[model samples]
Target: MKINPAHLGFDIDGVVADTGGAFIRIACEEYGISSLTLEDITSFDVVDCLDMDQGIIEAIFGRLLDDPLDAGLQPMQDAVSVLHSLAAKAPLTFVTARPHEEPIARWLEHFLQPDTFKSIRLIAMGVHDRKTSYIKNLGLKYFVDDRLQTCRKLAEAGITPLVYNQPWNKNGHDLPTVNNWQDIQALCAE
Candidate 1:
């Protein structure tokens, strides 16, 4: 089966890049505290648990002013191959909550070739819950994201949400989940 979507939406953090570790590390550094493991930061809120100021949070993680790609960020296993396969079939759009676009473009450039990601479009900034609106506006046939809330919102808005399975989202067994990009490729192919 060959399923070609008009547009596909993607989440940036756990979906593409291994940012959880970096976020926690930066948070610890900003607060002048001991290095935090991923487990320590997983259940804790970025603002409260890390004791980080808004400005520092924005500068390090929220805002992508700096070239995060150059910061040695790595793609999730087989992410590049899956994306390349998907792009070969249909348009791929990165729908992230990251406030800055340039850094994302740079980060994507690190993993994907210039031509493969040239058509990739960035959605509105600071629009986390409004992902359904973006999908509706863009006429995306399907969206792949790591957030269960976002996936629910997308489903409520009449879009097929492909939930990217992550350890953080494992508590509930209700949501539809896919293990990795390979599963997404298979889903898209169906």
Candidate 2:
């Protein structure tokens, strides 16, 4: 696909990879805290809801971010196929809040099929409002993300933010939300 960066944008984490699942896996397998449910992760700061110590949170994130193991992060069930289609038709850009570069790019590469989305862009803007800033600066007409806060920011800035449904940030927002990649494909095409 001859991708362009002017129109559509995406956020990684919950939207693309099941990072939340990976986090829960760590909390259960490594951190010795099992029995956590998706419903319990009421906030983006899921560790806070887990009643975990700061050190444990840091360790979990540290492993996930800086020194993640070889365990492959699972892509959204429909993500690979949907993204291939979208990237072929519309300009697709990925802007994530992850601070590092290699891990995320590598993760993306893992699922990127051969001869697809040659011009696809993966941009990292780290923390805070950087995601919003990047989206605005790029003048993206549409964006998909799981963070309601980020989606609200994009909506306020006159960008269409398509909320990808997750356990956290699923309620209290009347914004356009999609349940799966098929919905994302439909929404973006709309």
Query: Which lDDT tens digits does candidate 1 get at residues 1-190?
Result: 2346556678887787767656655556555655566555433235555544668766666433366765556677888888888787666788887666778777887789787888777663656877788778888867877777788888888877777776555566476677887877786775
lDDT tens digits by residue: candidate 2, 77-177: 88998888877775568888889878877777768865554566778777848687788887787788988888999899898888888889888999988
Candidate 1 Cα errors over 4 Å, as ranges: 1-7, 24-44, 47-65
Overall lDDT per candidate, in order of appearance: 0.70, 0.77
Candidates in order, TM-scores: namely 0.78, 0.88
Lowest summed-lDDT stretch of 10 residues in model 2? 1-10
**Model 2 Cα shift for residue 130 (angstroms):** 2.2
Give the top-scoring candidate (lDDT). 2
